[model samples]
Target: MIVAPGACRRLKPPYPYGSISISFGETLFNIRTDNFILGLTFLAPLAILFLNILLVFKVRRILFERKMNSSKKQRKSHISLTLTTLAIMIQHLASGAKTVIGIVRPELVPYALIIRHRLIDLGMISVPWIFYISHPMFHEKTARVSSFT
Candidate 1:
């Protein structure tokens, strides 16, 4: 449907829809109704973000209560895991970026996708490393049950 400031004409049903590929060189007047699904993409992230805030607060509260009773290693590991979970949840928001890819600067679609990919990839790839670095368990050497030398 081509829409002006105050008017819009619904495209007839021979081929009534547009796609992101077709929308690339076109202007905003070249409208489509498929944006609803795109809007749905952000819902998961929004819910996760809300849950993440709650989880962070709960973990902090628990850590505060157990501060003196828990060993330093236990406290450190708990904090490390909570922070990692929060970071990963934040990274999930980038998955929604594709919904707005060509809407605001159509020319930068490629760059936007690249940046989004990098952000998501960096977050996913760093998770194990973050755990390894933050938790001392990964750094510990296991006692040999059988001599391998």
Candidate 2:
């Protein structure tokens, strides 16, 4: 899950620099040096995305079914959660596509690498926003504090 540099490199002489080193479980996949492993790395995220889509659809259906009987705040929370989930799923797919493209198409690696960190930052920032909007308590506290001001 943790993709960091200098984690592990199995190349005979090791990669020169700026290589994609992904650590999953006990194995380290060095994409720049290993073509076969690079191609295989694509499967993990694709599989995850497939599973996520199915789960998201099921969750959305359940949320919608209970929407009619839920209070306004509950409805808002459900909507926020659904939207956040979809946004995250899309982010995951985009990241996976970028990784695959970077590995398969060497020419595009420069471009893909440039946006990688930005995408990660976006994902990190969105997590708190999702929690804030989806939690009723946060909204209530904000509303109360705003009323005092």
* Model 1 per-residue lDDT at 110: 62
lDDT top scorer: 1
Residue runs of model 2 more than 4 Å from their true location after superposition: 1-40, 141-149
Candidate 1: deviation at residue 55, Å? Answer: 1.6
lDDT of 2 by residue, 1-149 (tens): 33534455443223346465544433346434455556566776687778777877876787789888878787777667666766566556667878778767866765665576577677778867887768676867443444554
lDDT string, candidate 1, 12-86, tens digits: 333237412323334376665456656666566677777888888888998999999998888878888787876
- C-alpha displacement of 32 in model 1, angstroms? 10
lDDT of 1 at 66: 94
